[model samples]
Structures are given as structure tokens and as C-alpha cells.
Target: MGEFELIRHYFAAAPCAQGGVGVALGIGDDCALLDLPAGEQLAISTDTLVAGVHFPAVCDPLLLGQRALAVAVSDLAAMGATAIGFTLALTLPQVGAQWLAGFADGLGRMAARCAISLIGGDTTRGPLSITVTVFGRVPTGQALRRSGAQPGDLLCVGGFLGNAAGALPLVLGEREAAADVAGPLLEHYWSPVPQLQLGERLRGLATAALDISDGLLADCGHIAKASGVALQVNLAQVPVSAPLQAFLGREAALHAALTGGDDYVLAFTVPESALTTLAREVHVIGRVLEGQGVTLRDPQGQDITPVQRGYQHFRETP
Candidate 1:
């Protein structure tokens, strides 16, 4: 089928593409227009997922659709911004009606959940890949950033960590487990719920914030570097789900929580005063200190930082 016809039949006709608040002009226009409220700033983020590298070359289009958009929208949540709209640039080897329909359905479901609209994007023939750009808005000077963490702030995460990492073997078909063990882990990997509400509530409270796409330690290093403060991660305090521990064992689960990436949970720093106001789901794992890098502390307060922090796209090989 032709590009225009394909888009119209699949994505353009989806419920998310119908336009919502802040989307002035949606799919048909050359440039999508967004309306921002007075004294608010527009926040945007983009993420690309390649066929083999990011995900299995052959996988469920519905899950891929949900994952692609969720990961990108996590960026907006990190900044404590309210999601507005998104644009998807899809590159496919060939058109398949069934695949498009499933993908569009999943994407539309997630967009509706996040209260975000599908704005505009493009389609082309190529190796399979999906790029989603998300738009959000936050009041001026209120958006959380990575550079504002203070020495006395407490390091925290939105929810349980490492479930997605623990699910890797299951995702790649290398391992199998009971439904009880696999259900939660696989759900986390396939459909991570971005902590948008917690992020919005953290607007003025969180000094520095970001989504943990790259393991906890690596992502926390970013906060440390940006804020010029040391982060002391208490290994004992890091939260891990029961299912993950049951699946991978305590030690392995802890390791995964520390070094495995793609959790998409919000990691941030907030003052002691703000702790009382934080949601119940927030976990306090460490504290910010007047130092240079991230330091991992054992239960007894010994340094035990791992050699491998997290995934990097390109690194020197021995």
C-alpha cells in the first residue's frame, strides 16, 4: 500500500490521532502546532528503537507499540511535565495490515492512558525502526532538572527497580518460569508504566530528577555529575520486587537492580523536608553528599561499587 494510505488506514484513524488539548493542528498538517499555557515551557524528548538491537527483530507489535511510546514519555515525567502530544516516525521493510493494526491499537491505548495526543510523523521504507518524539509542558522555572540536587538531599526512586532487567532472559527465550514469576517481570519489560503522577507531584520537591533508562547506578551518576554532588547509594535500601527476587534470587536481583538498564522508573533527589510529602510508593535509597561521583555503600557502610555500571551505546573494547 502507499504511504499516505497506510498511515490513514492505520495510525491517522487511531483514537490518539483525533487531537486533544494543546494540539492545535494534528496529523494532516506540514507542522503540528502545540499551544502552551502562559508562563509554561514546552518540553520535548525523542527515542529510537531499532529492530534487533533495542528489541527482538521478531516480536509482538502490540507490546512494541506500547514500549516505544512509554520510554519516550518517561522523559517528560522526569522533568515533571504534563504530556501534550507525540509524533511517531515509523520505518518498515514492508507494509502489513495486521502488524499496523496491532501496533496502532497498542499505541492508541497508551496515548489515551497518558492523556497525550498523536500529532504528526512520517513513514518510509527501510530496516524496521520506530522513533517517537514526545511533547510536554511545565510551568517556567518549575521543571525538575538534573543540575539542582543539593548535598543534603535524599536520593529516591519512584518504584521497584530491576524487574525489567530480570525479564531479559525471559524476553529472549533463554529462560522459563512459572506464570507467577514471569507475569510481573514480563509485564514490567513490555509495558512499563511511566511515573507521571509522582513526577508531577515532585515538581517543586525534587531537586534533581531523571528516568532510569540506564541502570540505577549509571543514571544516578548522571545526577551526581550534573549537580556536582556525591551520591551514596545504600545497597540495602534499593527496592526490588518479590517476583524478581523469586525469579533471579536475592543476590542476582540486587545486582540487576544496580546495573541492569531499561527500568524507566523515575530517580530523583529531594530534601528531608519533602520526604513527608512524597507518595507512599517512593523509595529512599541513598543520600546526596559533597563529593564527586556515585559511591555504593553496603549495609555496614563499606564501598562496594561494581565495575560495570550500566549499558553504553559505544565503548572501547579490549
Candidate 2:
């Protein structure tokens, strides 16, 4: 089929592309337009997923669709912005009716879940890759930032960590487990729910925040550097799901929680005074200190930061 026909049948005609709040113009237009309310600022983020690097070259298209958009929208969640719309640039080796149908269904599913509309994008022939650009909005001065953390604030995460890392083996067919064990891990890996509500709730409360796409240690380092404060992560306080522990053992699970990437949970810092309000929503894993960089503490409060923190696209080799 032709490019326009493919897009029309698979994406442009999809319910998500119908346009919603803030999306002034959607597909078929030269450029999509977004209209933000007065006193609100536009928030945007883009994520690209390649065939082999980001996901298995061969996998379920449905899950891939959900994952591609969810990961991108997580950035908006990190900023505590309300999701508005997104554009998809899809590159394919060749067109397949079944693949496009499944992918579009998954994409629409996630868009509905996040309440974000599909605006516009482009299609090209190439190695399979999907790039999604998400748009959101936040009050002029209330967006969460990585540069606002302060010493004496408690460091927290929205939910349990490392389940996605634990699911890697399952994702690649390297391991198998009972449905009870594999279900949660695979769900986390394939369909991570962005902590949008928590982020919005933290607008005025969280001093600094980000979604944990890299390992906790590596991503926390971003916060520390941006905020110019030391983050003391208490090893004992890091929360890991029981399923992860059951799948990888306690020690291995703990290691995954600390260093495994793609968790996509929100990590933020809030002062002691604001902790009460957030006590139920977050897990207190550490505190901010007057210094620089991330310091991981053992049970005895000894520094145990690992040399390998997280994934990077390109890194120097020794």
C-alpha cells in the first residue's frame, strides 16, 4: 500500500488521531498546532525506539505499540505536566496489514489511558523504528524540574523498582516462570504506567523530579548534579516488588533495583514538612545532603556506589 493510504487506514483514522484538548490541528495538515490555556506552558518530549537496541527485533507488535508511547509520555509525567497530544514517526522495512493494525491498536490503548491525543507524524521506509513526540502543559511556574532539589529533603520513588530488569530474561526468552511470577515483571517491562497523577500532585511539593529510565543510581545522579546536592540512598529502604525478589532472589533483586534501567517510576525529593502529605504515595529511600553526586549507602551507612550506573547510547571503552 502507499504511504498515505497506510497512514490513513492505520493511524490517521484511528480514534486517538481524532484530536482532543490542546490539539488545534491533527493529521493531513502541514504542521500540527497546539493551543495551551492561558498562564500554562507547553511541555514536550520525544523518544526513539530501534528494532534491536530498544526492543527485540522480533516481538509482539501490540506490546511494542504500548511501550513506545508510554516511555515517551513518562517524560511529561516527570515534569508534572498534563498530557495533551503526541506525534509518531514510524519507519518500517515493509508494510504489513496485520502488524500495523496491532500496533495502532496498542498505540490507541495507551493514548486513551494517558488521555493524550495523536496529532501528526511521518512515515518512511527503513529499518523498523518508532519515534514519538509527546506534548503536555503545566502552569507557568509550577512544572517540576531536576534543578530544584534542596539539602534536608527526603528522596522518594513513586513505586517498586527493578521489575522490568527482572523481566529481561523473560522478554528475551532466556528464562521462564509461573504466570504469577512472570506476569507482573513482563507487565512492567511491556506496559509501564507513567506516574502522571503523582507527578501532578507533586507540582508544588516535590523540589526536584524525574522518571527513572536509567538505573536508579544513574538517574539519581542527574538530580544530584542538576540540583547541586548530594543524594544519600539508603540501601535498606529501596523498595522492590515481592515478585521481583521471588524471581531473582533478594540479593539479585536488590541489585536490579539499584542499577537496572527502564523502571519509568518517578523519583523526586521533597522536604520533611511536605512528607506527610506524600507519605502514602511515595517510598522514602533516602535524603538529600549538602554535597555533590549520588552516594549509595549500605545498611551500615557505608558508601557502596557502583562503578557501572546505567545504560548510555555511546560510552568510552577502555
Candidate 3:
């Protein structure tokens, strides 16, 4: 494709809009510019997607584009910062205008939805890889931190879990794509909507918060260690989607939900009084008590026997 065609088709587009993202000149120019607000500092994060590593090689380019940005945005969401701009660095084994078009289309779709913008990026020849760096801003003292959990705080999660793991079998051809069984789970994995608004709202109410990219048990331990408090998660209260239940029976469903990754839902802690207000956007699942570990309670009120260990990037990736 020609330079102008490439620019028009893929480079120039609006990003997701939360506060004022994509309000200024973005990509397709000599230099992208921004009108950053005064007093608020921008939070920045980056993530890379490698073929056969972060995602399957056969995955759709559109979903890859969406996921690449969504994953990076999740980091900003965890920080309670609004969307701003992003730059992409892409490495490709071969040039395919069609593939790039679909990827850009996906990127633009998400950018507009989230009010973000594609500011700048670079291209190189190599194995297929994409690195996206995002910037967001929040008022001073408003950004949430992982190290703020205190004793006696309520633990809550947005939406259900384990759908991705339950749906993995379908994506991998180990099972069929039965909508009744793993449809929503597939959607959760393909196009996870970052909970930016919820994270922003949680800034004051939540003692600590983080999106559940890793499993609940593992991510909760992050907060526990950071805050120096123990977290107790009630298994009965753990929410699972109907589709996930159908794909994996009750026992396995709960286990996968607890130990599965890529939920993108926010797992946060708030004071006891926050239960009522947060009810609109959150589901109370556990509590942070004074201690130094995480405990999962089974149905009979007895602590689960040796909770399954959570996600470890290098050691475990199945």
C-alpha cells in the first residue's frame, strides 16, 4: 500500500474517550500533540504481544489490536487514570496490508470507545510483535494504589470469572464453540472491556484495587503483601457466568475462576460501609482482615484445603 493509504487506513484514528483523549492532533502527522490538563500527572504503561506467547498465532488481527490496547489500558485503569494517547511499535515477519488494516480497524474501534488516540508508532521487520504504550492522567491523590488495603476492608469483584479458562478449550479446538457453553467466555478473552469508570469511582471508596489479569488468589496476594494484611475470599460468593458453568462443571468452574487469568475485572477492597454504594458496580466477595495471608473459604464455612497456587508467568502458562 502507498504511504497515504497506509496512513489513512491505519495510522489516523481516534482513541477511546474518557475525559479528553483524542481531543488533540494524533497520528498521521510529523509529531503528535496533546493538551494535557494542569495539576494532574499522567500515568504511563506499556505491554508487548508476541506471537505464540501473549496470544495464539491464528488469533484475529482485530482482536489482537483490541487486546493489545485493552491490556495496556488495564494498567491505567488500575491506577484510576483516564485515557489519553498511545504509540504502537510493531514488528512483522511480512507485510500484509489487509492484516494491518484489520488490526488498525480494531485499534481505532477501541480507541474511539475509550476516548483515546493513536499518537505515534514505529514499524520494523521481525517476528510478529506489538508493543503499545499508553498515557493517562488523574488528579493528585486520586489514583488508586495496590498498597493501601487495611484490615477489615470489604473485598469485591466486578462481573464473573473463569470464563476465559473455560472458553480456552473452545479456542484451542479441544472443544467446540458452543455459545451456550463458552460464548461469553470467548468474548471476555477476546474483547475485555477495561473497568476504567469503576476504577475511577473506586478511588476514594476502595482501600486498594487491581484488575484481575492474574487469578483471584494470586492477585489478592499482591494486595495482601503490599498492604501487610490478610485477605479472606469466600468461595460461595465467587461469581461465575452461566456459560462458564456449562463448559466446566460446578467444581471445576469455581476452581478455574479462582485460578484462571485474564478476567480484567477489578478486584478491590473498601471499608464495610462501601458495600451499599458500590453495589451498583461491584459485587462483594470477601474481606481484608488483620493478618498476613490469603484464605479462601469453602461452602461449609471451612477454609478450602490448600488453595491452588495462582498464575506465574514463566513457571506456568498453560
TM-score per prediction, in order, is 0.95, 0.95, 0.89
User: Model 3: what TM-score?
Assistant: 0.89
**Candidate no. 1 TM-score:** 0.95
Model 1 lDDT on a 0 to 1 scale = 0.90
Give every collision pair in model 2.
Answer: none
CA lDDT, candidate 1, residue 143:
96
Error of 1 at 172 (Å): 0.4
| Regions of candidate 1 where Cα sits further than 4 Å from its true position | 1-4, 307-318
The number of clashing residue pairs in each candidate reads: 0, 0, 11
Question: Residue-wise lDDT of candidate 1 within 61-165, one digit each (tens)?
Answer: 999999999999999999999999999999999888789988888898889889999999998889999999999999999999999999999999999999999
Clashing pairs in 1: none
Sort by TM-score, top down from the best: 1, 2, 3
Which wins on TM-score, candidate 2 or candidate 3?
Answer: 2
The 0-to-1 C-alpha lDDT of every candidate, in the order given, reads 0.90, 0.91, 0.78
Worst 10 residues of 1 by lDDT: 309-318
